[model samples]
Target: MFAPTINSLVRYYHTFKFSHLDAAIVFFSFFQNMNF
Candidate 1:
């Protein structure tokens, strides 16, 4: 059940063509902003 959720997220990300680096940058910035 949990695995399918993760797989769907991965597929969605690929559908949008986000590179690993791009995703990392976005995640990092999101966390940084949330800390404020």
Candidate 2:
């Protein structure tokens, strides 16, 4: 169940044409702005 959820997210990301680096950058920026 958890694996499927992760796979679906990965598929959706690819379908939207986000590169691995793009995703990583967005993720890093998001966390960088977090207070905790």
TM-score winner = 1
Clashes in each model (backbone N, CA, C under 3 Å)? Answer: 0, 0
Candidate 2, residues 1-36, lDDT tens digits: the string is 657755765776778889888878755765566646
lDDT of 2: 0.69
What does the lDDT read for residue 32 in candidate 2? 68
Error at 15, model 1, angstroms: 4.4
Q: Estimate the TM-score for candidate 2.
A: 0.50
Model 1 Cα lDDT, one tens digit per residue, 1-36: 657755765676789888888878766765577689
Task: List the candidate 1 regions with Cα displacement exceeding 4 Å.
Answer: 1-15
Local distance difference test scores for all models:
0.72, 0.69
Clash pairs for candidate 1: none
Clashes (candidate 1) = 0
